[model samples]
Target: MKNDSYPTSTIANNTKRILVLFAHPVPQQSEVNIFLFEDAQLLPNVTAVDVYAEYPDFNINVIKEQERLVNHDVIIFQYPLYWYSTPSILKEYQDLVLEYGFAYGKGGTALKDKLFFCAISAGGKEEAYQTDGFNHFTIRQLLQPLEQMASITNMTYLAPFALFGSRSASREDRISTHREKWTTLLNALATEHIDLDRAKNIENLADLTINGANE
Candidate 1:
């Protein structure tokens, strides 16, 4: 695969750890997300978890989840955009794991200063999520609640990395390229090569121009 314009390994380190909370109810049927998760899992300092598979009963293990969060510097909530929000289990994970005096409230310093972001796959085209489009709002506008969640927890919120039109027919090369970029970003993130502020301000981390955002 071509490296394209971005330097996949321009920098390197495993100091910052990453946790990918992949919440797909029917992961077996996934075409893109599953591949991204598996590739990310093979990288150094990255942990990918299938949330549904781990807690099928919706009975979350709060302590264990919290422990997982504590070990990672970056926490990624990866899921397909369902009704402009996350899957039900992610909400459940938050409700159960982010307890008082832990994720938010007095002494809620566990996730403070950590990095938090989302990776979403949308069935609609990118233009459909704009002011004049059928959806009538940008992706960022729809993610305000998540941004607030990061604010409350004192975590840095980076704009999401999204793949739109997932339900549409796709060319093999295009899919291959997007898959490569997924691993590239994961590698950059593990090495602390991304400019946090740049990532936060960018409209779309998946934009091809994101090469400029990497440090």
Candidate 2:
């Protein structure tokens, strides 16, 4: 059953609509993203779509999904990082919904002028994502493919909103931090306060923490 609480036309009015495509295999087992999504859902002009729950059979409604994309000004992909990438369903959704003639290639102007961002939860510590760290690569490098995808689709790619140390973060801390960040991101998007130029220059959302503080 699709959640139509926030219709597409309603999204085009008053505020810039932010469609959050949330993908998690087991939401009950999630600690960070769940709270973040819950908090984000409460904000006006923000709509949360549980991809896994909505399309468990992988039978995605491409037209409907594309319609949702065209109606919103910003698209936020929310998920738990799996092996340094997004969950399986998200990839599937991208492949199916963001088709060649629709999101890219000739006549693919549906997503043009739109914005794309990510909100992800990682199981590793921040240090581990560094060049000399265990993971041996920055999160920015790991997420380059999505940036390229956004570029190909003519969408403005913004810095992601990431929560590291998910595996070790205390339940209380996880909830608190994710909620705060979710609220902050929503407010920035709602009020057009985000620094798009800075967001495009940075590799990862974490990098924005250092840059945003200076601004």
Candidate 3:
């Protein structure tokens, strides 16, 4: 994928900047992630990028992605939870975009002091991800690799924004509450209202309540 040049802006003295990396293979078939990306893109300080649309062949431009990272204060990885992890393209993006000297290892200060987060949709129900539930392991446990990645890169890893019961969500349900959740999440990221410490302490992103402007 070619590097698409976007206008760079100075981070506000007291405001948090956020970058949302959205990846969905079949957007036409998505029930929740598409709405989440749409809502997230409306935030003033959030730069939302659709990876699948940009790098359809998995040829990621590492330099361009790193440049985007350097310009943002917070980073968000948004996608659906496929096979208990991110989509294949997202993993490829991670392997390519987050390089050895730019995102981690020595002299990799580009992501330093920045925040990292995940926004995901799961086909399973909320109760299915519990210890005694069908899925067995919790969502947080499933995301340990990402948390370790953040730790290795010296970024503050925040809790995820998760939408559960996606497979059963009706169109009307998505239009009402789910869309509102996406809007609230975007607003929170743009305004620095997200509590990273508290978010990290939670076991499931679905259980975390976002206190938005309407609330």
Candidate 4:
């Protein structure tokens, strides 16, 4: 995986170590996520990993992945939402790296108290993911499995930060706005400026705004 880390001296004091596990099967076709991923790489106290690029053979190193998790205070799963779930490689990564003894079930507390969340881009519009809409479920409802995974692993699960209408986001200013929000959120998360309680209660963090008031 591509690991991006800032020098120890350059990192802000008391900032959280953020680990972004980015997964995109075909990044060239992406209109927005690739830019967000690139922005994440430029931030201090953040480690961005392109999982697809690193584990093309599906041969993930379990020990190293566990170590990465242990070292970071925040974990972000960044990807394009596929069939209301994560990409196959990420699922595979979980299966291989989050072993019974390492993540849960009897003395497993490697990820305890850490924050976990996803950054997803959806092809459908926000309205289409409602009870009466085509998807017949909210984005939060569709992501229960991951939430439960975080719970079982002893990590605090936050609402996902999602971009809807992603297919057409590039046509207007939506893509640019979304990228700006992503950067702002990342910075807030790194500096512990984000309110965790509010984060968990929100449906999504796409429109999240952090200010001195919240801090």
Task: Name the best candidate (by TM-score).
Answer: 4
Model 2: lDDT equals 0.79
Residue-level lDDT of model 2, residues 52-86, one tens digit each, is: 99998999998789888878888988999998999
In order, candidate lDDTs are 0.82, 0.79, 0.78, 0.87
Which parts of model 4 are misplaced by more than 4 Å?
1-13, 212-215
lDDT for model 4 comes to 0.87
TM-score winner between 3 and 4, please give it.
4
Candidate 2 weakest lDDT stretch, 10 residues: 1-10
Error of 3 at 214 (Å): 6.0
Please report the candidate that would top lDDT against the real structure: 4
As for candidate 1, its clashing pairs are none
Q: What TM-score does model 2 achieve against the real structure?
A: 0.87
User: What's model 1's lDDT at 107?
Assistant: 65
Query: Model 3 segments beyond 4 Å from truth?
Result: 1-9, 171-175, 209-215
Give the clashing residue pairs of candidate 4, or none.
none
User: Positional deviation of 88 in candidate 3, in angstroms?
Assistant: 0.8
Q: Model 1: what TM-score?
A: 0.89
Better of 2 and 4 by TM-score: 4
Q: What is the lDDT of residue 23 in candidate 2?
A: 95
